[model samples]
Target: MKYTSYFFIFILLVAGCSDSELEPDQSIYGYEYFPLATGTYQVFEVTQTDYLNTGEVVTSDFQIRHEIAESFVSDEQETFIINRFTRANENDDWEYLNTWQSRRTEFNAIVSEENLSLLKLVFPIEAGVSWNGNSFNSLEEDTYVLDSLSFPFRLNDQGFENTITVIQADNQDFIVSLDTRFEIYAKDIGLVYKEIVNLNYCADENCLGQEIVETGIEYRQALLEYGAL
Candidate 1:
């Protein structure tokens, strides 16, 4: 009889362990960093600087807005339509610029801009994790790394309690070229800042490492306001 009782207890313990192992993880995966909802919109202050090979520089300032205009099902997942609008200044009327698409999967988030698909972020956000940003596109493979996670970031006098930084590319050769691109996303606010600097420096022997930008573009975007329309 004691042997039978011991066997029953062993069976119960095994079943309990199996049940626990089968339970799914209910923890958050940091998807809130790129929240998507119809009518949600974010406006940004944009600055574009063009470096001419003739040694002339041109700069322009404007405002851009991205709104989740609509959504549809694609590939068995919900995809959001992003409407982009631009204006020369806060007092100017917004003009329709273009349309973009965004979607989130169980493992990653994707954004399609100008018909080019880009993997923006991965699930279970963790600092130091990296992935190929051009996995879904035909462009050359580029590694994207999560440089920071759940960190505080302040922009335009507004403070964000949780933010993440994704480093897309950071390469430079003082004598010939420079390429640096990164984006910052704030929890519940979406992308707050973006910067892209790609330039070619003078390669002459005397101008080596002189950092004279020749022909490239410097683009910056900072969040101005955001809300559900």
Candidate 2:
């Protein structure tokens, strides 16, 4: 009798533990962070040319550090901004793109509807190759991307060339704070010229006057471009 009673109690405990009367699981959404990368093509551009320090482009490796989106407000007013920088130099070490701690920007779905076919610079924007033997991109051509920050993206021509307007869907809105160029690999495309792009959105007469903002890009070429091998 005692043995039977003990066995019955064990089964009851196991069944109770598996019942919904136990504890519930909990989870939280993880946010991401991104910062603009230092100018490397600039190194390539000024190759053999005098720059901040070295007289020539000996090693392509450099350092890049800046603040990222520490957090975000899950609303339509998606905003992001960074104010510190130092791009391998002496004079412009800790300066903003032009000024320090300058004003940032905000964004909606439709960034700019203006004649954006201009102002915006194109990556592989050279239309030609660089001194190091970069090639001119072809239609539907593909190359190894070194960077891929799609922050300042304008979906015109599917990102083939610059000077194209960005079009978004009806229901969905944009979620970036900077109005700069979205980062990506210029594979078969061209040189990475524009780091930040300003989107000018002016729809109609009422909303037609003038409203512009900045957006930064974030891409991982090390992974996407297959780094080296």
TM-scores of all models? 0.89, 0.20
Q: What overall lDDT goes with each candidate model?
A: 0.92, 0.27
Candidate 2 whole-model C-alpha lDDT, 0 to 1 = 0.27
Which pairs, if any, clash in model 1? Answer: none
Cα RMSD of all models vs. native, in order, equals: 3.1, 18.7
TM-score attained by model 1: 0.89
Model 1 lDDT per residue over 47-166, tens place? 999999788999999999999979999679999999999999989999999999999998989999979999999998889999999998998989999999889998879999999999
Error of 1 at 183 (Å): 0.7
Clashes of each: 0, 22
- Model 2 RMSD, rounded to 1 decimal: 18.7
